[model samples]
Target: MRLPLGLTAAAILFVLTMVGGAILDQLNENMHVRYRDASVALERLEHASERISGLLREAVLDRNVLLTVGYDNLNRTLDTTLNNLEGLAESFGLSREVNLLGLRRLELQDIERRCLKLMDEDRWGEARDLLFGEDFALSRKLYEIDTENLVSVLDDRLRREATRFATARQASLGVRGLALILLLTSGVLFSRRLTRELAEQKRLQRELTAARDELEDRVRERTRELEHANRQLASLSYMDGLTQVANRRRFDVAYPQEWDRAVRHGYPLALLMVDVDQFKAFNDHYGHQAGDQCLQAVARVLRDSARRSGDIVARYGGEEFAVVLPGLDTRAAVAVAEAMRWAVESMRREHCVSDCADVVTISIGVATRQPKPHQEPAELLAEADKALYRAKSAGRNRVMVWSGEDVSFYI
Candidate 1:
């Protein structure tokens, strides 16, 4: 069943308190075990040191013996004592305390050295006298010190373990009391709080779901509106306003794709740039409004003349237009240029500045090339512009094609 947060927290607190009590109890038991083990190790060390000291005392009392015999027995006893002390220190993890034990062991070592020195000098009586006298006394004193240190370590360990046990016991009691309080509080408040919170949560969940659904619907409507707006913007971006044909922006976008395709398929692509002759003079004679009408008419003719599906006709700017045709060679491009020139001439608009006749004629430049790697769009336009200049130089109302090899002026 569902429950309020406060009640849930109280129950969780109760469970955590019980778990913590169990952990603390286990820790206290481990501390007791360690204390017991340390005490046992200390007792063993004390007994071993006492036994070794008793042997040294017995050897010293027998002063009539040769120095070699006493030295050998004492050396063996010292070795055995050192091994036992090291083993005990390791088992108890008492490396720092072992340093003190090491100092005591050094006293036994000094006694052995003195015995060897007496033997080297061939002074057996003096060596026996030293062993029975100061050396034996030092050995007994070191043994007493070792026993005292072990007792002190054991006492300290016991105190620490006792303190730890007491602290854990107190903590366990406190935690148990808190757990009982938490459990009781949870039990008392569970029924009414659980019922109220569950109802509130359900109400909030329903409200949130309704709000989410409303937001989704609004988003869908906004998405549809944006899609329609994007289509209108795309159309306006690519189409000329006056002529309803492709604009220069659209031509620029399509030209690169066509050029790449031509190169891939080893086909020819052609460009035609057309300009109206004496258009400024015509505008000056008639007016800006009539000049616009003439431009619209020319735009219609260019659009209609682009019969191939791959042809693009665009209003480049005032009094200028461009056409792109794919899969067309130079000869075919020249024919298309001528057709466009004649179409513009057919309009028969009068212009007094015309050198050939009193007619509005278009000068056309055609450039055709099989697309190649590293060819740029500006190269094609430059060729077409050069050809257009040639057509104008040869008298307006004519078409010219760029020969890839020579820059000769042509008509």
Candidate 2:
């Protein structure tokens, strides 16, 4: 009797293993298809990134029309790959990764435009320097490597899920085989064994749920970090690295915005261009190290002097600074310039080689205008520059305001 029961249990176990294997095989095939699709897309994006880099290198190094055309062609291909990546974002439901890719792509486009502009200006060395720069190279590496890793991780996760499913199926088969053996030994034993197997199945389900929840938490945390980094990058872009004030780029952005606002409101807009007196002599006497410190001091004074909500102080290239005054008339803007002069005098940073005085001083040029449809802002800038030149020609430590008349309106 026992021999017959054992034979029956073996027969049932064989059937259970065959069914489990067939189900796992079908699921595994589906997993492979998804993995292949994601990997192929990621690889294509990586290839496009490398091609863009190579094209840029050739265009910059050769400085030929044909190379430039080749570079442009590759840029178009890169744009297409970027679109494909966008589509993949929708397919994978990965909004954060897509957003980062979009940002990187836009930055690359800007770099490309800048390269073209430099080439047009006949600045071959500068254009070559740009492609060899760390910023663009790092940005390309980040986006390509990140996307590739993301695809690999996703594929790995899919593989893991399939493996877990197979493991569970195998475990179930083992339990069923045990139940059959127990039944062959005694009917009561089979019922107890089935009850224990159901409890173990619930335990495994709980483990899987916990793991998925943890993974979701990690994904959300990573998204937050990326957003914070983006904000920081934006802030740094507008700031002057040496002086800690707004840079030329920020001034360019703010100038148009303020001009438009002043035109709409019929308010006065003022611009003050300041030059550190005898800065070249100071640099020559004190050495470059001291020159940097002096500039920082001047920037600090200017920054503190223009403390109003609508006031902007920026480093307008070497040894020159500018203050943007919104909603201020000519007199008010002149007063602001005088205060800035006094602020620099108060710093008392010694410049022995100076023609103006024994200390660091600044000559300021003030220009004010109420915006009109007939006039252009460029005129205001030209007038201010002329006034600055006058201040420098006539003793370097004074303030001169520009009037429509042929001369500077001295203050």
Candidate number achieving the greatest lDDT relative to the actual structure: 2
Which segments of candidate 1 are over 4 A away from where they belong? 1-222, 405-411
Model 2 over residues 38-77: C-alpha lDDT tens digits? 5666656665666566556655654643446666676677
Q: What residue pairs clash in candidate 1, if any at all?
A: none
Tens-digit lDDT track for model 1 on 1-411? 777565567657656765776687677666656555555445455544544443343333333223135445555654565566556556446666666766766776677567557656766666667666866677757766766777687667667767876787677667655645554566655556545644774797699699879978986997798678668866765777777888766877888889889989999999998888888888988899888888888888888889789899987776878899999998888888888888888888877876766988999888988889988878988898888888888887899888865664344
TM-score of each: 0.46, 0.64
lDDT of each candidate versus the true structure: 0.72, 0.77
For model 1 the local lDDT of residue 346 reads 89
